[model samples]
Target: MKFWQSVEHAVTPAHGWAATTGAVVAPVFHYFYGTGRADILVVLLVCTALDWVTGIQAAKKQDKTYSSEYGLSRLPRTMFFLALPALANLLDRVMATPGFLFYGVTFGLIYHTWNSLTANAHRAGWPVPKAIVNLVETEIKAKTERAMKQKEGK
Candidate 1:
């Protein structure tokens, strides 16, 4: 339910705290602030537990059961996430500043996250574009319905 846990649930459904933090959060902080590697590790441990709970919710919603195999599959997802920070670091060193590295890596993560999400959605037999459109439509419907209900109540 925490911020990082939410991020993990969004990006890698089966990810845990240790892998997410160690691969994603710690590296980001280490590159950005140049301190608190230890803090990152500890926080990730807690977030991993939180990820499991959220993963369960996600699995139930999708009508699938949880398994250790699924959790372990997130290892590759963690590696993919980690690549951005590593590239950022290398670019920072070569470019003599963090600007390009930071933005480039940020965008890379965004793009990769979207691509992965779309792929997973497709694999789950939810047509990607239609699913996105449905989500948007659903949001609009909810908002409109809420407003109408409020008006009637008033």
Candidate 2:
């Protein structure tokens, strides 16, 4: 398949940027920091579980009804953690990039960890790290309660 087709096929909600961040990038970082391959898998699983728990928390906090779609979308993302190495190997063969698997894992772990941090901080009314804060301003001195007050006062 062509590159666009590959991207299109991969562009489901489950395989989108958020899931990649949570499953791939987060685990990749742990792997980079001297984690063994097996340990990296464990970390990926942990991060996926964390994603689910956080998703549930967010839904509950918002009083939103959970859908089967949400669960379905999440499953493939978790699976991507396991599949990425193989996929990267294939890509490596095709692109002549030797470290494709490593790149895949490292990027995925980094993405997920940063995403998790940002989401948790947002939920808690705190600021996430500037490195992954996206478009939001990073307010250093404002605690949760103060942020809430400032938000309400606005």
Candidate 3:
């Protein structure tokens, strides 16, 4: 084959795969995040990356080896984080409460991740104020309890 034909042949399969993946993902993404809200996912991913990096640094500071196996464990955690907001979005739709559950769950997860990141930062030798840590802990606990009570009431 000629050079341009060879290049096209190589790229054609990749283009097909990209189109197929986009087709499968687009609707699900739109359903979960709604239109023009990809920034929510981007923020979640960025926060997750920061947490992972800080966790690795903390492990190093503590003279512990952060293995790839442990890093791989984060996949499930990240999936849970993503799935929770999707579920909340569904709940919001069911209740006809425009974006309330979705945004609440997403922001809650982000706040929790922020807490984890701050703790990791402290472990990695950056000092975080105790009051801020306490407040975060309290908020998380309150939210958890409220969720549990709501579940029980239902």
Best by TM-score: 3
Q: Say what the RMSD of model 2 is.
A: 15.8
TM-scores, each model vs. reference = 0.38, 0.45, 0.69
Name the candidate, 1 or 2, with the larger lDDT value: 2
Please list the C-alpha lDDT of all candidates, in the order they appear: 0.52, 0.56, 0.76
> lDDT (0-100) at residue 64 of candidate 3?
55
How many clashing pairs per prediction, in order?
Answer: 2, 16, 0
Tens-digit lDDT track of model 1 for 49-96: 444454444444443554566568877876555555556666776788
Off by over 4 Å in 3: 1-11, 63-72, 126-154
Off by over 4 Å in 2: 1-36, 90-100, 124-154
Writing each residue's lDDT as its tens digit, candidate 3 over 64-95 gives: 55567767977998888889888888888899
Candidate 1 vs. true structure, TM-score: 0.38
TM-score of predicted model 2? 0.45
Error of 3 at 67 (Å): 4.5
Better of 1 and 3 by lDDT: 3
Q: How well does candidate 1 match the true structure, expressed as C-alpha RMSD?
A: 17.0
Instruction: Give the number of the best model, judged by lDDT.
Output: 3
